[model samples]
Target: MTAAGLPMEIRSEGLPTRVRIHEVGARDGLQNERTVVPTEVKAEFIHRLAAAGLPTVEATSFVHPKWVPQLADAEQLFPLLGDLDPQRLPVLVPNERGLDRALALGARRIAVFGSATESFAKANLNRTVDEALAMFAPVITRAKDAGVEVRGYLSMCFGDPWEGPVPVAQTVRVCRALLDLGCDELSLGDTIGVATPGHVQTLLAALNEAGVPTSRIGVHFHDTYGQALANTFAALQHGITTIDASAGGLGGCPYAKSATGNLATEDLVWMLHGLGIETGVDLDRLTATSVWMAEALGRPSPSRTLRALSHKE
Candidate 1:
């Protein structure tokens, strides 16, 4: 570490020179909050993320308020973010109605959340795996017709609490389906965080063999078993560039009790910078933002790097 709390730059062999971090703090992070954050605070959090140079920050979800009350203020919150680039502020749209809500608000980019396992599909979406994919098909098609970019989030790509270890073939089939349905990118989510480095590489290779290119793939790993960073490095070695991370190590699958916080932005950035990878983010500013958010949430951040750097500050 340097005197300023930054990591020493040491370039890694054959890694992408730059990585696009799809910051999910405001949308994914706060959605799991026990209490509903004030709409203005959510707006401010997004502004801070953008100012910290996160290229794509998921702004909010247009899911029905009955489902996710934490983001019930999506309609009110999105307008406040008009000052930011709409393309960079992707929102989650669960169905056609959700897509209509997001489009009415002028969301230029949207994401559809799905599951790779039957249990998660039923528990999270109240449908079978195939049924959930069918539901997303029209939503994705409509988004594409409207010229809105769509990202597919496939949770439980590695293991499921109910189903145990998910098969690589099963994951690749669903990934290809989502891509076939017109999703511009797919974020492989180890929702219960049971993935190790080898499992990650295996899944990535399976997807590649199934004709899903690494350039169109991103990884979202949870740190439940303390393997998120290691799994991420495995993906990096396979040429997967986009990563989904939450600030302050916030967010877990509300439907999956065993799931924990996502791969923390602070932790990921520390590793990426140490490897001399470019993320275009201001580490100090991002850490400060997470610290501020931790205070607002009335808890200490779970991020090791955030805690360490903030202590020095």
Candidate 2:
């Protein structure tokens, strides 16, 4: 057994084998910022992330400009992306209208988000949990018909700013709804970063009991309470391999008060590497990218490991 008391036999072939790092800094990370990141800068950020060997990067969101003005340049930005390796770029779509916009731009991969918390759903999308699911059903069907791979997000899975502790059954219900709607993968988001290892264990166990396979689930965490990495380890213990992270520790829910950023790509990679989990990421290069982006954003990285490593230099 490993240090966490999980089976050692589940370890991958090589030490720290590659895991898919979903770069969400451009989309999830920047969306919450008060300042508008210039289109050119956003494009350059994506280029730099790709150069750092990140395979899948969420480039931008296609929400209504009134809702998220930061990504209002979605149309202009989409074309500017200019021949990105098609496999590397996935964009976020909020509803059928957003999906239509993405499909018109020839986007083959897309993501849709819903919330496990009723309050979060109403606050973020102005809809209830069931209403949000109903809204996305047609969008998911359209995307599948158009041959697009769809990823579903369950936000506020751990806790919500308004609702406090969220029940695991509610989260699983959302997950099953998305899966039924044909989402290729479902990412559980700890929107307020209130998740603990114990919570992660309970949720994953519940999902497993509900027959949701580990392969179809992904974990998206925030560092608001500094429990992201610990929670990540817990998810890994439950056989969850896919993880969502952002460069320079960028991103938090705009609807979540006093929320911090997503689990930093650098920190998550460091822990996964130490645990001999193959995330197929280059830690040194990832850190360099984080440093560059942090400089561009004019803020110090929130990644503990990145901050420490840079200090060592």
Output the number of the lDDT-best candidate: 1
Off by over 4 Å in 1: none
lDDT of 2 by residue, 159-261 (tens): 8877788989988888988899899999999988999999998999888888888889889999988899889888877778788999989988777776789
Question: With candidate 2 superimposed using the best TM-score fit, by how many Å does residue 67's alpha carbon deviate from the native?
Answer: 1.0
Model 1 residue pairs with clashes: none
Q: What is the lDDT of residue 133 in candidate 1?
A: 94
Lowest lDDT block of 10, candidate 1: 304-313
Residue-level lDDT tens digits of model 1 in 231-305: 999999999899999999999978999999999999999999999999999999999999999999999999999
lDDT of 2: 0.85
Q: After superposition, how far is residue 253 of candidate 2 from its true place, in Å?
A: 1.1
TM-score, cand. 2: 0.93
RMSD per model, one decimal: 0.7, 4.4
**What lDDT score goes with residue 90 in model 1?**
98
